[model samples]
Target: MTTYAIAHLHQTELCAEIVEYLEKIDGTLAPFGGRFIIHGGRVEQLEGKFRGNLIVIEFDDRERARTWYRSPAYQAILPLRTRHASGDVFFIDQVAQPHRATDILEGIRVPTAGVAP
Candidate 1:
């Protein structure tokens, strides 16, 4: 399954760090077929309030996302994301077909009621 990553920054030196990272550490994701779908750009606030920047990335699967994050290349950029940005970072598995009903169920692991459900 495909996976997506969302990053929202409130007060990060995220831009500068991202530039540095792209220049040097982006190679790690090459093998994983990682791609940038959304970046820090213009956004229209039609709902909730937010500040700083927003980023969204797509990867082939969870493993690639995990690998890219831990890989040396990405790790090299980690400090920038850490020192600069601070908002929300999350990963989600994509659904082949978009459906509101299924969307609600995604990632909702209904644990056995008896043992830590």
Candidate 2:
């Protein structure tokens, strides 16, 4: 399954360090087949308030995503971004194709009133 590394970065500083991070990040991602699907583009806010930039990088699978994140090349440059930005970063698996909105319910277990969950 495809997986994504998503980040919502706020209060980012456009400093020399950040510039360097941007220049070098591509090299780190190439070996892992990770590419940016979204990178700080203009957002159309339809509902709740949103702050800062949203970044999404796609990977072949969860394991590849995990490995890319943990790789030394990526780790080495992580501090460059971390020192200049404040945000949330996480990995999420893509949903299967030909799916329904209710498909997720199958993996969720609701406890019966008399049973311990």
Best lDDT goes to which candidate?
2
Q: Candidate 2: which pairs clash?
A: none
In model 1, how large is the Cα lDDT of residue 23? 79
Q: Which pairs clash (backbone N, Cα, C closer than 3 Å) in model 1?
A: 12-84, 12-85, 13-84
Please provide TM-scores, in order, for all candidate models, with all chains considered together. 0.75, 0.89
Estimate every model's Cα lDDT from 0 to 1: 0.78, 0.95
Candidate 2 wrongly placed segments (more than 4 Å):
107-117
Residue-by-residue lDDT tens digits, candidate 1, 1-117: 999877887876637765676576457668788888887899899998878888888998988888888887777777866776678888888876755765677678867767963
Top TM-score: which candidate number? 2
lDDT, candidate 1, at 31: 78
Q: Using alpha carbons, what is the TM-score of model 2? A: 0.89
Per-model clash counts, in order, read 3, 0
